[model samples]
Target: MSDQSSDAVPAQWSAPTAPGGDPIEKASGENFPVALRLLPPRIREDLRALYRYARHVDDLGDEWAGDRLSALDRIEADVRGLYEERREPTDPVVAALASTIARRRLPADPLLRLIEANRWDQQVTRYETFDDLLAYCRLSANPVGELVLHIFGRATPERIALSDRVCTALQLLEHWQDVAEDYRRGRVYLPQEDLRRFGVAEEDLARPTATSQLRALIAFETRRAEAWLDAGAALVAGLSGRARLAVSGYIAGGRAAAAALRRSDYDPLSRVPKPTSRQIASAWIRSVIRGWG
Candidate 1:
């Protein structure tokens, strides 16, 4: 409902879909359902539109080969086109987002923040501290939860705070999972201070298997993420029906992914650990049951 961070929105232009995979499927794999069959048609379509917008931005940020900043700028212009100009957009994803923006009255800021996060990604490759990393999450991840709340008509200050915790935790988990892959791409999401504290060299992250020190560092980081995730799960109690189900899926997915990481002894360097279907189902059921309390 409000801008939680004071990130300046930049103006610029280029719209290229990140080349590789299906955006919806890619989003689904990241820990939550975009559009579930059981949701009402309107909500399902709305969620699909949101996912497309997110996927389009993420693909450009993560995979676009040329001038990513300008690409982000182009997308942001289209987003502003939807809200500010009230005109059709050249990019189909941003074009599709028009109705959802009108229907939900979603702010341009969150969409702009998503683009800002990617722009930050291009410039800031390594985080020097945990606090710095959280700032990045404000740009990169928390806005999605904020926008989701607006979509469900549940964006309140209290709920937004809780959602921020859940979103940031999920982002941290993703970074931990992609340590090796990120290193290869010339980025490191793990805070430099933590690496120094745990004696984990950047080179250690690129190893085929994690060193003992690296595993220890990951274990420590996983614990930090789970604490925030558990605290945020309390948000589910305040929600009901489909909104509760969707938020519960997010909590469950985060917990399940954390469990998977633990099962691998927090050695993400060996392989990117993922929650199995049973784990996801079990966590989701537990979350739903707990929410009934």
Candidate 2:
């Protein structure tokens, strides 16, 4: 367990240590772009609020070295503060997020779902089937897009449905990339049925190199992710202006991550694949000009 002094310090939420003196510096640590520079300042701040909320909850679940569940309990209280006029937003991240929630008239459901996802993480580690995995994604990933759409004033039922597919695909892409590391954490995101089908046993994940069977299974999952991604492509085509660009970035990110898996030939245990900067840039441009589909 980490020492109390360190655990008690909210260094991540403290006034930024960066020369710019903005906590936005922490945004760079995100897997996806939270606030693109080209976006309007107001829109960027809105996205940043969502990003910060997600990021802090993620840290409580994954990065916190001690007493994580207790920390989460405290965070839950602060989240309630956002809804109550009499309660103060005691946490910096929560306070900033409260502002966004107020400004956009965002629903509390998606944000609450995100917090619940991390709480679920405390008890659940492995999934039994693809459907089960998707259920987990509904909690862990889908809320992010739903919240973003709300921020952008684009959370129609149709768009939220497509966004779910995209978000779920992105989550799967990340899981495929982190298979080995996740295995080390005693958590396997891969569906057990798929593992059995491909003859890729759990022990294969602990190896320094991926077995042929493991490679095959990763390839299969990659294709499944691709299909989900393709299903959401229409989401980008349906939007305009900065919302269009933001969704385009998401589609391109999924493509780039999927490409990385292919480039590694699915040998994730040996070394996880990642898209090059050039590949990401190209995909972003293509997504803009050619559309996500």
Candidate 3:
């Protein structure tokens, strides 16, 4: 899809000063901070700007309690206006985003895809097959990787393919960890085909401990996520310096998360699996060494 425009700042452009703003927190949070710390000052600032915008868009989709569809529509409009630089955005997130778009020449399609994925969450609740879930990942996950590529100015077709695999694997790992919470959200990330193959029902996901069927299903999905990480690992070789470090961090994060799932024995209802700091550090070291070699 063509971008909205690149001229004319919007009428709403102003500083965002909300105390404890959700978007601000997400931008500064642990997950987005991974690559930011490894970047130069200017690039880090730019990433923070981009992250704030994306975070605001996601929060509008995930955290808004009332009229989520309307909120998402507004976010989409704001995104278009931000790209066009036609509307004055009062929120700091939007303000930062507008500047990043102007400076980086970032495309509008990834942002639009992200907003559309949030819109999908409002209507879609179940995934019937792996392909179905992958379609969702195309929207809900892959744009982040695309944005990362755009920031680094390294968006070749092959790199994008590898990045897609890594990003989708990260998304799947997240889903595996959040099985209980997703169920509470009236969503399930496990493809129905696999669930049927393992003879696991939706109700079985709510149990405190997983049954044999649930364990089997989780193991199956975990292996798929691992395969994605393995396939995408070459993305590190395709980059250098800070960009390489950033991609390595991403790969390490996925591997660490997957290891956490394995350590948890694929139980979904007990608690979400999270990698310890030690595990992440070890993985990062290994990633660096491997990259050097």
Candidate 4:
């Protein structure tokens, strides 16, 4: 959607180096870190490549100094070059993605969708409904789960449907956790309709601590998010070997995060709620034993 032509782009945009830091290191902040060390080396590396590409795309959308829309357009072009045009991507992240695409025979649509989500971020600051928020999750969060399925050779249509529920739940939990932060960034992930239903105003999100109404709204959303996560628990039972463990870890991490939010009485405006290692470990064990009861 950027009006700038390819010719107008700066030279650095051609093959942008990673701005800084290890993209993999960011896993610590995620609901579940992909590319866990316990997985086989090849799977770990492939997932890392995917994570790096995703992180780079997110950074360009969130933190890039130049035209964010133009930057996102360039990343999409790089992905298309690797897939549609069979051209080598100049950007290292896309280059890594190229290898994953070839090895897994992955589709370009999901990758393109992720880029599209970032583009949407530039223009859309508020969602009208919970459905609209889920629509955004389909573009931003679901693709990572799909890509992981392809890497593990488990991407059936049914499994993908299940994964979407899990991914959307994770995305919602993240939105709940970062409500204040998102407000500071001039965006609001909470649906406007839900805000009205709970008597919460947009200005309420800017407060240093959540008001009673805001806390009640978050509680309602938390229950909704937990239901979505539970809907995807069957995904763990459908897998075997490391694939099963990995998927279980994702569900466990979501459960742990949800618990942390509840412990905070769902008040994200005061302080961000985070799951401790012990909570995550306990959830993982229960997931393995109970398998989403």
Q: Give me the displacement of residue 98 in model 3, in angstroms.
A: 1.1
Score candidate 3 by TM-score against the native: 0.87
Clashes of each: 1, 0, 11, 0
Q: CA lDDT of 274 in candidate 1?
A: 80
Better of 2 and 3 by TM-score: 2
Global Cα lDDT for candidate 3? 0.75
Best candidate, lDDT-wise? 4
Lowest lDDT 10-residue stretch of candidate 4: 13-22
TM-score for each prediction? 0.89, 0.89, 0.87, 0.91
lDDT of 4 by residue, 1-293 (tens): 24656535454542223325444445413666332546887887787788778877887888777788877877888888887776676667788777778898888988999899999999999999999999999999999889889999999999999999988888889889889888999999999999999999999999989999999999999899999999987898788888888888888888888899999988998899878666877888887788652
List lDDT for all candidates, in order.
Answer: 0.80, 0.79, 0.75, 0.82
- Residue lDDT tens for model 3, 1-293: 01223233234433332246433224311222243355687776677676666666666677665566665666667778876767775445565677777777788898889888888888899999999999999898888887888888888889999999988888898898889988988989899888898899999888888998898888889899989989998888889877787778777878888888889998868887877656766787787877631
Residues 14-126 of candidate 1 have per-residue lDDT tens digits of: 22332353333445237664224456878767777887788778878888766677777778877887777865677777887888999999988988998999999889999
Best by TM-score: 4
The order by descending lDDT is: 4, 1, 2, 3
Poorest stretch of ten by lDDT in candidate 1: 1-10
lDDT of 2 by residue, 1-293 (tens): 34444225455543222235433444322235332566888988887777777777877787677677777776777787678775776677777788799998888778777788888788898899999999988988999888888888888999999999999998899899989888887789999999999998899899999999999999999999999999988998788878888887777878888988999999889897767556766788877777553
Extract clashing residue pairs from model 4: none
Candidate 3: residue 193 Cα off by (Å) = 1.1
* Residue 10 of model 1, lDDT score: 27
